[model samples]
Target: MMKHKLPPIYFLHIPKTAGSSLGQLILCSYPQGSQLNCSLSQLLQMSREEISQFKCFAGHWGTGLFSLLDKEISSITMLRDPFERTVSNCLFIKRIVVKKFASNPLALDEVEDLKLKSDISELLKCTNIREMLNLMPSMKEQQSCYLGCDIDLNEYLGVSQCSLDTLDKSKEIFIENIIAQQLSSGLLDINEIFNKAKQRLDAMEVVGIMEQFNDSAHLICNSLGISTPKNLPRENVSPENLALGNLTYRKSGTIPDDVIKQIDELTVCDREIYEYGKKLFNKQLQTEKRKFFWFKKMFKKSERF
Candidate 1:
């Protein structure tokens, strides 16, 4: 009998989705040395020979990485309700800034850029989600940006490793928007970006829903020809951080209706992609069920014979 080989997987991990947990399952399905989890900059530094050795590539990278790949791979990602994701992200950032700055008021000063320092400081004062989103304009349509934006492989290859190293430093951490820069600069209109993202999404082997995580995990396992685990790991859940206690950001029913309206406005593009993802997920689920049903029937017939 020939052993089955799984295709390489590229997990385009959009932030605030349950990608961390899904990533663990993916890594477990492969052998120890066959998994590589790193930032886009780190991946860019690898020679093709070095990169091809890994069976799994997972990270907070955008679709742009696709153009740089040396081999064809199965790509997968999860989509969340845009409003929920956007709000969760705002709360998470708020929690982090408070915790990090409370320990050292000077850390805000350490952020370097005058504008960024001002922004972080402004974020510190934000009494509500609307205020935070207003300060972080790049965060709007963020999900679409990840799925839509495609980089020129040649351009990134020419960039200095040192400059890329700076990206790894805190300069890009939690604040800088590599994907949003293109959108902010008007390199591509939001509609164009959303359409591209949806097109790429439609082509993915698995498009999981965060709300339907267990089923999503099962579908991913099916794609990899692996047995589904009895329990899917839940990692990096939005913490009920005490730091944001005064903000009440994570509590259910706490967000104001007007604020929700603002989130809806900001996530207009992301909202459409999310709805599209849901339809795709449902279609894939039905197909998987049929395959499973046939597999069971065949096994029963073979047992009688």
Candidate 2:
């Protein structure tokens, strides 16, 4: 069969949302030299002529790029369960904390300063959600942040907007850089950010759910008019065990009830976004099924004729 021509795609990859898996699928669908996995800064630097060169652009750049894109490009994203995504993201960050502490004695001071206990049980403990958000400032409304930004990219045009450079600089500032990108629109209010993000979602061609990986993958393929890959890739997965001496914190372990509550509280907008995405996904799925049903019926009728 001749391959279906695909529109240029811009994947707004929300962190820890099985984006790596979806990104891999996107990578396989496109031919070499057509794919561009780049930073937001690089994307900002590109001219319209330069941007037109690629059929695929996938990155953590978030919604700021939408202003630069034309109708020809399809924007796609996947969202995970808000609470679950929060825990998983924290675990990934905690792995870095453990590694850095092991490598450098000075890093111990940073961990202590944050009031994070050395034990796995106390790793995510906090007095309240605000305190937790203070530590992982980027974690607040993170999903919505990636999905929404102001139409004007002037604020986000700088290097600090979406740079992960802070990850290496200090544990205190590790994910804080993401906060700047999250608030790129200068929308300090969480509700305002969420409302804008929801509008962005409504504008997206494909809003997928991480839990429904296979279905989401198929939805993306269907949207692109391409065949779905037989094996879906699962990359950057949170490990079952960490390098910190048999640290078992992710899969089998139970996150603290208080921490869970805090995460739930923190991701109010993201939770709504998740539910909204699910409803949107189901609608899209049903529509696709109906189209397929008609195509098959028409084909059979033609055979009878």
> 148, model 1: CA deviation in Å?
1.0
Residue runs of model 1 more than 4 Å from their true location after superposition: 1-3, 106-138, 157-168, 173-176, 241-251, 303-305
Candidate number achieving the greatest lDDT relative to the actual structure = 1
Give the per-residue lDDT of model 1 (tens digit) for 234-303: 7887655234543434245556666667668878989899999999999999999999899999999999
Q: What is the TM-score of each candidate against the true structure?
A: 0.81, 0.77
Model 2 pairs in collision: none
Please give the CA lDDT of all the candidate structures.
0.73, 0.70
RMSD list, candidates in order? 5.6, 5.6
Please report the candidate that would top TM-score against the real structure: 1
Residue 232 miss distance in model 2 (angstroms): 1.6
Worst 10 residues of 2 by lDDT: 166-175
